[model samples]
Target chain A: MTYCLGIQTHQGLVMASDSRTNAGMDQVNVCRKMHLYIHEGERVFIILASGGLSITQSVTTLLRRDFDQGRGLASAPTFYDAARVVGEQIRRVGEMDREALKRDKISFNINVLLGGQIAGEKPHLYLIYPQGNPIQATEDSPYLQIGESKYGRPILDRGVRYRLTTLEEAVKFALISLDSTMRSNVTVGPPIDVVVYQNNDLRVRRYRRFTSKDPDLQRIQFQWEHSLRKAVLELPDVDFDEGAEQVI
Target chain B: MTYCLGIQTHQGLVMASDSRTNAGMDQVNVCRKMHLYIHEGERVFIILASGGLSITQSVTTLLRRDFDQGRGLASAPTFYDAARVVGEQIRRVGEMDREALKRDKISFNINVLLGGQIAGEKPHLYLIYPQGNPIQATEDSPYLQIGESKYGRPILDRGVRYRLTTLEEAVKFALISLDSTMRSNVTVGPPIDVVVYQNNDLRVRRYRRFTSKDPDLQRIQFQWEHSLRKAVLELPDVDFDEGAEQVI
Candidate 1:
């Protein structure tokens, strides 16, 4: 299991992914789910992958092989074209592995959030489904998440917007979403990778990995707990039936 | 779809359920998912159901049939016995419907969160699975949720504790959780039913339905959005590559 999120805002774009992977409770491992393809100032594409690790890794490896041969990412003229190339790569990998996986009773599955800006186009973000089709984020839905998405979706629904005018806020909200998932699910863990891009900026502005003990994260966790408790306590009580015996 | 949550705390228990049912996006309807059985000064048992509506309704009907025929709710010897009776009722319903559901390629699925106090037993909470087996809440895990539970689980993870000492706080947290789900998923909607039980109190302390127009709920929605935006804005920005052109 995994959790990955990507947001495209007026200010720029923010991408975050956790590094935990587990086959079962005792078979956990750490693997980077976020992959980057950069052409210096010309373009930078980030892909946050989730679902079966085998399928995603196969897709990533096939894309890398194409790039290594100068067939796709290195040569695609636009972000949209690059996305198509990535999609085709995923399809190619699926064609090669799906039958074998079916023989083992495993479903061929993978989903990805692909986002970045090219030299001449606006920065865009998309959620690529396991079937290779994709949906781009719009003003009404400025963020896309994959794998273990539900636990973190509510915060994004209430907080994210296309006019997220500040990169700081984007990062914070992304972390808070991750924090919520981490607390509730054992499959998602820390050492989170975050990358921020400023609108029109062709280069990656901020890229960092946050560990569990990071002071800022610790503070956010504590503050969230404290505030939640306070909020719960502040609500007015409802009237109870008079003859009700106290259960506690 | 439905969302129902139940929490057992030192002070008592809190149970809440949404009133939405849908066969698809266009076939949505309102239906209460909570059932309360209270015998003044003697016992009070709340059942919050979720999943396939038919299965849940059938299960509830079977339980009601037994109670009407003198099987134990108001006259239950103990809370454990009451729970067993509920479980037995579920099994009977499953026996009557499981094969037919399977014939239609539908899942024979429904879950219930049962909690409240009986005359001779302590306040207890149980999460009954589709198979009619149930797990009781303990000090380590004091809450159980059935159907569309993921969207609201994060808040509980961050706020609920066995030491949580007040029923009011529990009720508030439960509402907050429900509100989060309602915002993110259209299938879970307004007019939520909530019941708060005080330990040793044989009757319900508070019971009400919350709608989108409710003043208190509106206040919570506003405050939550404000606080969330504020929290996001306070997060530190990620350091990006200096020469990168801003994407916006």
Candidate 2:
């Protein structure tokens, strides 16, 4: 399992992923899930994946090789085309591995978040399903998440506004979302990978890998915990009216 | 299709549930998911349910009838036995409906959280599965949740302490959790039902059904939203150092 999310705010995009993967309780490992393709000054693509590790690795590896040859993401005219290129690779991998995985009772499962900007287009985010279909995020829903998403989703649902949240704030929100997930689930953990791309920058400018002992991560976690408890304390206390009807 | 949870603290227990049920996008209704059985001064049980509406309704209906006749929860000697009684009823319902549900491809799914005290025993909480097996919440993990649970769980993971959280705080946590879930999921909505029972009280007391228009519920929602936004604002900003290695 992994936790990967992308926030598309007015100022730019914030993409993040945890570095933990597990086949079972005893088979946990730290594996980076974020892949970047940069044709600097023209286009930048970030792919965060979750699912069967081998399948995702195969897809990314194929994309990387083609991208290096300037035939995949590098040559694609738009983010949508790049997404299709990714979907094609996913389907290609499915054709190769799906049958073998099914024989062992393993589903051909994988989910990918593709976020980037082409020189002429606005920054965008899309969620590519295991079936090789893609759906883009819109102003109405400015964020996309994959893998162990729910525990961290309430915060994103509440905090992210397409036109209101700045790139910095979105980065903060993304980290906090990942933190919440890590606290509630063991399979998603650090060192965390984050990329913040400012609109029109055409480059991955801000990136960080936060290990468990990073001081900044520690500060954010401690501060958020304190604020939440304080927030909970500040709420009005429950008052059970005397002789109230017990409806339940 | 529902959200329900139980928190057991040293001071007592807090149980809560949202009241929305939907068979499809167009078939939505408000149905209470929380039920209580009380033999004043002797024992009490609060059951919060989630899953197939017909299946849960059948299980609760059976429990209510048997309790009124003093044959089930009413006659149990301990909370564990009470949990067993509930599980037996769940199993009975499964026996009656499982095959038909399978024929129609609808799962015989029902999950229940039972929380209360039986005379001489400390307050306890149990989660009964579709298979009629039950697992009790322990001192280390004092809260149990079912149905649309993940969105509301991080707060509980951070705020609930078995010995430290008072019943008042537990009730507040339960409400906030439900409010978070309601915001993220349409299938979990209001008229929310909540019950708070103090240890050894042996009575059905302190219950409220919060309609969407309920002022207290509104106030809590507004306050929590405000606090969360404020908390996010207070977090330290991200500084993207130039020349940072791009790990992604």
Top model number, lDDT: 2
Q: Which 10 residues in a row give candidate 2 chain A its minimum summed lDDT? A: A239-248
lDDT of 1 by residue, B57-102 (tens): 8888777766767675655687777777777777888899889989
Clashing pairs in 2: none
Best-performing candidate as measured by TM-score:
2
- The 10 consecutive residues of candidate 1 chain A with the worst lDDT sum are A239-248
Query: Where does model 1 exceed 4 Å of error?
Result: A235-248, B235-248
Worst lDDT run of 10 residues, candidate 1 chain B, spans: B239-248
- Candidate 2 residue lDDT tens string, A1-248: 89999999888889999999898999999999999988889999989999999999999999999988989888998889989999999999999999999999999999999999999999989999998999999999999999999999999988899999988889889999999999999999999998998999998878888999999999999999999988999999877865426564
